[model samples]
Target: MRKLILFDLDGTLVDIFDEHINSFIRMEKEVFGVDIAPEDMIKNIGHPARVVIAGPLLERGIDPKVIEKRMETAYQSYKKQLGKALKRIGEDVVLPGVFRLLEVLSQRGEILGLITGNISTVGMLILERTGLVKYFKVHSFGDVAAKRSQMIERAVELAEEKYGFTIKKEDVFIVGDSIPDIRGGKEFGCKTIAVATGLTKGSDLEKEKPDFLFSSLENTEEVLKAFGDQI
Candidate 1:
């Protein structure tokens, strides 16, 4: 089938775990001067960066405008740090079989889009660093929409606008490692494929009962089969 596969960038396709944690730590310590539990901090991730950084500050009674200004300053630091961060991610950061999977899908004429919680710039930077940029033609960024479901919806809408053709929900697939990915895909009426390549395990993803689930996308043939490959 010629499917439009919208992929979650961070944990599903590329491993940005280190950069994510470091950036959050810097933002909290330097910008907010607060220490956040890892779990608390991570829960903020996979959303818009501004929203993620502002949640804790807002809870501490920080003014919304002040939080905005602080985020602007913090974003500058994030951009600078990303230059160094890019050096650490490459083929290693790309999950196993990602390249092969992308290549095969492309050859089969399937559309590939990106749906990511990282802001547009950071998301593009990560893709460039991982050599995954060329695979995606469209994207719905976290900065543009705070919710993953919104991003998924945007991806479909943008694709339709770009191609001037309606996309069937059954022909759409959302692939990610997080619960939000599954929830967003399910809510948006796309088949969800949960890959346990991130913090979430296969056992956990199973409870979500996505249309398809895998420990990882290491097996390209099997991954293709999950999509009911007709090519």
Candidate 2:
């Protein structure tokens, strides 16, 4: 049996909450001429960015093609701005205990993978900048499709194909910071571990019925104690 752990990047691994919110606001205003409220935008934080943009465009009767073009332009602007912002903020720091936990897991021969809503480019940039890129052996990006479940499904498939091992639904864990992460993981019958490091609070995540919940990556010891033996 192979034990695989899939992590969500933005909130679970790196703290980019405010940077993302502001970046989206800037892009939305530049391309759509509409200022999105942070609260409203926060609601869609953990899903694919393209799907998030397209949903509202459809509601407003905009053609998907046009919306896609505008989104590309907006994303370009966001990339430039985000690059500058990252320099000022320095490389993102890992949440407490993350390094230690990942080190232990890697040494134990557990498969570590990434399934994030961020596009491949942006996700890679963040991981490279944070020096955490080495931890992930497989990744599924949001740019592949807007649906979260679809992204995870692809990641799982890639894992199976690349590693030459079968992964049971229960043997896979999706660790992330929002309800969508929990929902998507469950949709595929994988275990869900919710963390309260992003927009959603622990209490709110609890109501969503994830298999597990934690305040932050600092709970690494607890996580290992809970799941390490299974691996």
Candidate 3:
């Protein structure tokens, strides 16, 4: 029997803050003819691009249907540009000690998966480009659900379906860098581990009451130590 570990992508495995911010700025300018500050966009972290874009547009009194269409067009264009940039940059480097921890977990035969707010296509591109794709046997993307808890539930379902066995909530671990991730895991009765590698700080994540919290992936030893007894 294998324990399932699901990870978030953007802030978990890749350092794409700059790329994401720039992309959003470009998209806003192209779509709305207004340049948005990167800071403004960063505040929308942990949310889907559509939601982020729609929120601002709605606040500005833009028609919902028009905003949705323009946002989608802008996002698609930005995606294409970001994809090219990623190809040029090659695989995003694995967080410190992440590769080592992954190797240890693989050797120990633990099942790994992905549960992220990114769409399937974008998540696949990020994982495949980052060389982390092989580590996950299953994945659930934002497109599957509008909420984080729903995504986690879907991932569990996929895991059971793919591996031919049911996984208890307690046997599933959710690792991510946002309050939503922690809250979703808690709601689903999965062990939650919050990492500070993303936009959220350790102090902020503490408020969510996750099972564990870490500064970054460099502390994989401590993370493994925390999970060792259970496995």
RMSD of each predicted structure? 1.9, 2.2, 2.1
Alpha-carbon deviation at 107 in model 1, angstroms? 0.6
Per-residue lDDT over 79-177 for candidate 3, one digit per residue giving the tens place of the 0 to 100 score: 776676677544645667677777778888888888876667777888888888889898988666777888889989998999899898888898899
Preferred candidate (lDDT higher): 1 or 3: 1
User: Relative to the true structure, how large is the alpha-carbon lDDT of every model?
Assistant: 0.83, 0.80, 0.78
Clashing pairs in 1: none
TM accuracy, model 2? 0.90
Better TM-score candidate (1, 2): 1
lDDT of 1 by residue, 157-204 (tens): 998888778999999999999888898899888899999998887898
Which residue runs of candidate 1 sit more than 4 Å off their true CA positions? 59-65
In angstroms, the error of model 1 at 80 is 2.5
Q: Judged by lDDT against the true structure, how good is candidate 3? A: 0.78
Please tell me which model should have the higher TM-score, number 2 or number 3.
3
- What is the alpha-carbon RMSD of candidate 2 to the true structure? 2.2
lDDT winner, 1 or 2: 1
